[model samples]
Target chain A: MPNQHLIEARGVTKVYQTKDGAVESLKPLDFSIREGEFISVVGPSGCGKSTLLKMVAGLLPVTAGTLELAGKPISGPQRDVGIVFQSSVLLAWRTVLDNILLQAEIRRMPKAEALAKARQLMSMAGLAGFEGKYPWQLSGGMQQRASICRALLHNPSVLLMDEPFGALDAMTRETMNLELQRIWSESKKTVLLITHSIPEAIFLSDRVMVMSERPGSIAAIYDIDLLRPRTLDMMGSPAFAVFAKKVRAHFYSQGTLDH
Target chain B: MLRRLLLLPALRPFLLIILLLVLWDLAIRIFKIPAYLIPRPEQVVQQLFAEWPRLLTESWKTTQATLGGFALTILIGIPLAMVIAYSKLVESYVYPLLVFSQSIPKVAIAPLFVVWFGFGIFPKIISAFLLGFFPVVVSTVMGFKSVEPDMIDLARSMGASRLQTFFKFSLPQALPAIFSGLKVSITLAVVGAVVGEFVGSNSGIGYVLQVANGNFDLPLMFAALVVLSTIGVLLFVAIDLIERLMIPWHASQRQVF
Candidate 1:
């Protein structure tokens, strides 16, 4: 059988040395992500879900075991990955266009190409006319969209999102979920998303990996059997409800997940 | 029509100044106050014209000292702040020293600067630097530190070097705060320069004040005060304008009007 895995992790663990002593965060996480697959990790607040995401992004070092991308060990910040943080994190001083172009600038991409690509992404994100506007000028959803545009500007192979829409209101979050699904299908990149909401995880992911509480290990992994190009209407369908119930069961069994 | 024109933001301050000057002249006349106490606005304006050449030269001298010290404050203070922000060790060792340096009054230190550097523009610059740099260091440090660690992580994810992360990420975010510090520092720099001049100097507006007081030239002293205040207001406005230019996207610089 052909190995379609684009990202591989074997016995990966994270131990944070706090002032109190060694704090175990993740206990030997073992998972693999295939190319062009959308994977979402759902867990309780202190379940080291974010810790695992950061590790995959190569922002935080894994304390032990192996984490590999394309057969190469991820030793440091991986240039092939794009990250979307919570809170939008848009620079207040830059215009929407410049803010999106910031990633290209950091990578020393050719200015003209970057500008063109930034404009294209802006239009795709429905921010075409607002290029000259600042972050403060845009609505919360718009600012987050611009940040998403920024993450995709450099065309990284993998997109890692850590609760990117957690700050948005309910109505906006639903719309963003739809847009994100479209973006993922069009971009054809491997995606790893960390989230708290079971419905969101099920709606966005090919496989939802549920993690347990502190010193988190994968509690269960469910492969969604729903048909693709899924619609918001499909969310009420039997297959979707089954996935949602299965993910929610983990949270209810492991105590509250209000986090 | 005249009232409507004066209501414009640009003309409002001038309108207020004129109103105050008229009120001042009326009060002096009605109270039958002596010229020696608070010179009439007309008499002060007359004195200002008569002392125009002297006031011009003195103001130029004060301006040079203020700008010099302010330039020094920015050059030294910002880098010093960056150093402290970049390292916890440096901040631990230097932050206390900074606080201690600020504790000893700058006005008291001015006389010492005169004694060391003599009664030259150098002492005035030194005094202004001492007074102005503290605020810059404090504000710039705050600005740099306020950057979200996630912002830095994002930069690192893009392969941004430390220097790149600072200039490209931290610097722009910190600019509004840094500009605020500059505004405060510039005003303090004028006071600092004047303090140095008062401690020991033959030129500058402060020196002119002393000479006018010695002869009891109240009108001339009032004229000097006007000149000194004009310099302070102009420099503060200059820094404010530059902030608008540099960080137009800043919340403080956002368009409300």
Candidate 2:
């Protein structure tokens, strides 16, 4: 059978040695994400969900196991992958448009073409009117959206988002979640989101991977069979509640499993 | 109404200076102070115009030395900061020595600089560099070392090379701190040049001040002092303008509410 996955991780483990002692952040893990799939990795605080994301993004070294992106061994960060974090991380000095154009500039792409694409992405992210404004001048949600636009400006094959909307307020977060779903459907890039929100994971992800505490490993993977074009109404459905309950149960069990 | 409101803030300082001048003139006239003891503002202005050519030449010399030394400081200081910031071993070994050297006042070393480099612009420039170098290096190091970790990670994850990270992120982020250091260094640069001139130079404002003192030319001395103060203010304003032009994103550049 042909491997339809865009990214594959097998027997992955991460060990961190501090001044006090050695700590294993992530246990040996095996997972794979299919092309154009939105997968959210949900786990307790201190779990290695972030560590796993970092390794896949090529921001951290894998102590063991293999990670393949587009059937190529993960060596270092590639321009083909875009990553976003909780913080907007937009360059304060650069205007919104310029910040989005940074990736293109770094890649040495043609300025006119890059800018045209950036303008499209900005409009798609609802940031067209604030193109000249600095990051500090924009509201939190707007800044986060600009950052997302920046990540997508290069047309990366994979989007790795580590709690990108975690810092926003409730209303903004919900709005952003809808915006993100829209963006994802529109872009059709494979996404691996590391989030702590169960409802968010269930609402946005095709598969929610619940992780165990320290020396973290996947406790279980819950598949959401909900139909496409999911909306806030789907979040209130009984089916959504069932899916969320299943993931929450796995998290509860993992807390006991750690003992 | 708008124009008047715009002028109000600046007018306060201008009015304060005028009040100070009026008070000084009145005190001199009422107390019948001798010109040798305290030259009146009018006398100083008259003397300034009379000795304008000499005063202008000396001012030019001092300005040249200050600027030359400041340029040299930037050339040396930024690289030193980069090296120290990039290497922990170098920082640990060199940082203490730098602190110890700075503790030795440049004024005390002025004569030694003159002895070594003679009564040329070199000694004065060296004095200015000594005065200006520490702030530049300290600020540059702080700027380079204090980059946000997330920003670095974001750049790294984009496959940016080490040099690209430094140029794109580190350098820009450090600009505000570097400008702060430059502002302090530029002001001190003038004082350093003047001190070096006072020690041994045959020309420059400090030399003119010494000549006026010997002849008891109080008006001339006050004129030199005014010129010196003006040079310091102009140099500082130049640095501020550059800072505004270069790093307009800095919080310092923002207007208060």
Number of the predicted model whose lDDT against the real structure is largest: 1
What lDDT is reached at residue B161 by model 2? 85
Over B105-217, each residue of candidate 1 has an lDDT whose tens digit, in order, gives: 88887889888999889999998899899999999999999999999988998899988998899999899889989999999999999999998999999999989999999
Candidate 2 lDDT score relative to the true structure: 0.90
Q: Tell me the spans in candidate 1 whose CA falls farther than 4 Å from its real position.
A: A1-3, A254-259, B30-32
**Residue A17 C-alpha lDDT in model 2:** 89
What lDDT score is found at residue A107 in candidate 2? 83
Which residue pairs collide in model 1, if any? none
Q: How would you encode candidate 2's per-residue C-alpha lDDT over B135-180 as one tens digit per residue? A: 9999999998998888998998877889999888999999999889
Model 1, A73-161: lDDT tens per residue?
99999888999998888888778898999999999999999999999888888899999988888899999899889888899989999
**Cα miss at A257, model 2 (Å)?**
15
Q: What is the lDDT of residue A14 in candidate 1?
A: 97
Model 2 chain A TM-score equals: 0.96
